[model samples]
Target chain A: MPMTIDSSEVLKRIEDAPLLSSSASRLLQITADPEHSLGEVADIVKTDAALTARVLRVVNSAAFGLISTISSIDRAISYLGERLVVGIAIDICASQLFDKPLTGYEAQRGDLWRHDLRVAIASREIARLAPQDMAVDLAFTGGILHDIGKSILSEFLTGTAQSVLETIEKGEAQDYLEAERAMLGIDHAMVGYELARKWQLPEPLQQVIRFHHKPSEADEEHRSLVYAVHLGDIIAMMGGGGTGSDTLQYHMDSAYTDYLDISVEQLTMTLLHVEEEFSKMEASLLDGKDGGT
Target chain B: MSNLILGVGDFGASNSPGDIVKTFALGSCVAVILLDPGTRSVGMVHVALPDSSINRDKAKERPGYFADTGIPMLLKQMSSMGCNVRKLTVKLAGGAQIMDPNNTFNIGKRNILAVKKLLWQHGMGPVAEDIGANYSRTVSVSTNTGEVVLSSPGRPPWKI
Candidate 1:
């Protein structure tokens, strides 16, 4: 029987997916606190043997090309810094959770990984460029995980790829998100929102996940952050990075640039920088593992 | 025949049959492939923007990034590779709107138009193409067969 890919089913997938270790979850929770300390984050990571290994592995990997060998979680946190530790500890769970070919979205093996990584890098750069306007660190996490729901929703959209895309692109629904809501009764963004909540991610991250595609709908308080991730996702897709069926399905709102006080030229240059970074990361982190989709 | 990768703002021409040049992840960008059957040479360039005027510095620095500058450069290179400039079999793919925020700007459409205009100026035409859709395409050209193949996610690859 074909599975109906409504919100409940996606939520169920998130529920069924491997739960993050309690210790990792706790460490992630403190990241939401403005006053969270590096030691405090380290202490939480140390509770789980597996979490400690995960943090140390990424820090010590050739991706970082570290000079010193770190033996302890505390040492790892001190060396890598707090937000990065938090980002990576959560990534330990994310890599396991979202690592797969999401056929519904037409993503081949490794496509989503590359796409999300590009978005993460793009959003992080945007956040850095606008440090006074938004919380850039959180933007990095939000940028990568913004498409988390696609990991679940992709399963449901598989058989419906052509029709769904046609309806979204040609139909008068304005965009894919609308077509998704109108036709599939759900969209990837909303599903991602539920997954973020289910994983106990920070509320800001959850909101960005839900609103990454629609920055205009996001609250004004962190709209800049939302816009950053939004632009990051768009920029990533602009290069066709890790794309599937619904590529042209998104409609760019010019208002987003006005909201962030950025010009298209700036955005274009930012995309170039991020793409350069992406090539370096792909060369080192994902070299020869690619079967391009 | 080694495959040379064509990154954005890059163009290369090869007469070696061992060379199979290709580029991947084309969204709003376009990949232009020019093949000369007589010389057994192929030239491919991944163009990211439509106009060189987007940035004069960028246009001067990387001619392969824009269609206006890149297309002429690519044609010039393909001709210099022992091919009759007027007799090349030009093929194009990419120009997808996969990542546009709104339809307010269509770089893909602009790229296709610019390339076509340049070809017209040269009194040449593309023999085949697989252009304009919302999906990312990985386009490749084989100097061995003078064939171009376009692949998108979940869909079967088709010859252009």
Candidate 2:
């Protein structure tokens, strides 16, 4: 049996929910203009104490391979650069957005968090291989939040939605999207795109949420970034880093190669690279959060 | 039944006996399987991306994840297991496109192409294979007979 989410109710809840702002506004402002001074970005970051602490902790983490310790957000921003600092802040912000439990997905409170982090790491690595025209940070952000819609649906799948969850756990036959489409009439990607648009996320990220599961549908301008996230998600899923509820729907779009100017040879190399990076990033991101939220 | 088992996130074991040398649910990644009929040995790798040169730091942490780095490592491991490079027969699988058509995510295609290129460079070519499909696959290789099989949803098991 397929799953379903009441689109109207989901949309209503999203609308009613308070717009929780993290450091995303400041980070987006910084990313919009590269020439924007670090002082300006730092000033915005200083307003949020929690964001400031997360930023400093990440900058000091071994993932960046910084030789010296970063004592403050400003120092870390200087060391990591405007683009990456902004990217990390945005990621930290979205982490809160996805902190809720996903019922249909069988994801624990933090399962989505780990999944998003893996996709971000993989997307950044894949972006390095694509043409320089692509924005690597944009790719990373898109990858991290590609499944935001799942969180929205999870909340509404209250009573009868339990069956959908059961079907997923059994690994019966249907992919999550199909189950969702059958049960809820709308898939997570669509729901995610709606939420993204409502939240005023950047176009590239919204495009990713809509097309990460279907990259061939993306426009020429955003195709490569969409493709990177698609591949990154696949790499994470294949490596056993997935949330384990939706393993049946591994779909691949062939046109992605032609769009990205990459051959089959390049794809193989890229997946290898994604796997390597996921391992490193996974260790770094989960360093002390063992107790599980 | 002494079937060779390739552990998760790992590659290559030759001259071992087992029911299968298997890699599971390869989506955008590629699995390169090498079989030696003479030695009845088999090896397989579940690689996530095509290259490691993009980020050397990540590559160093997980060598088995990239095609450029992992394929060579697989070959070296096979050789160390008493399998002759010349007698080794190769087959490839995985690299499914799991996203939409318009999104331009072709990492699976890239991994498939990368594996083929690396094989060509190393004077090794795939004798038979199934790659670049739109669905995920679980690949299994029998060490006893060097038979490679692919299983997908609603599809019959087929030999490569």
Poorest 10 consecutive residues of model 1 chain A by lDDT?
A284-293
Would you list the clashing residue pairs of candidate 1? Answer: A247-B98, A251-B101, A251-B102, A252-B101, A252-B102, B1-B18, B1-B19, B2-B18
lDDT of 1 by residue, B91-142 (tens): 8888876444654346577778888887788887778887876778888888
After superposition, candidate 2 runs with Cα above 4 Å error = A2-5, A15-18, A33-37, A63-65, A81-103, A106-111, A122-132, A155-179, A214-259, A288-293, B1-160
**Candidate 1: Cα lDDT at A54:** 60
The lDDT leader among the candidates is: 1
Q: What is the C-alpha lDDT profile of model 2 across A12-121, one tens digit per residue?
A: 76675445365676566455453667798788778987667666776667666777877787887786555555555655555555677665555567767667767776
Global Cα lDDT for candidate 2: 0.68
* Poorest stretch of ten by lDDT in candidate 2 chain A: A284-293
Error of 2 at A96 (Å): 5.4
Q: What share of the true interface contacts does each candidate keep?
A: 0.56, 0.25
Per-candidate DockQ vs. reference: 0.46, 0.16
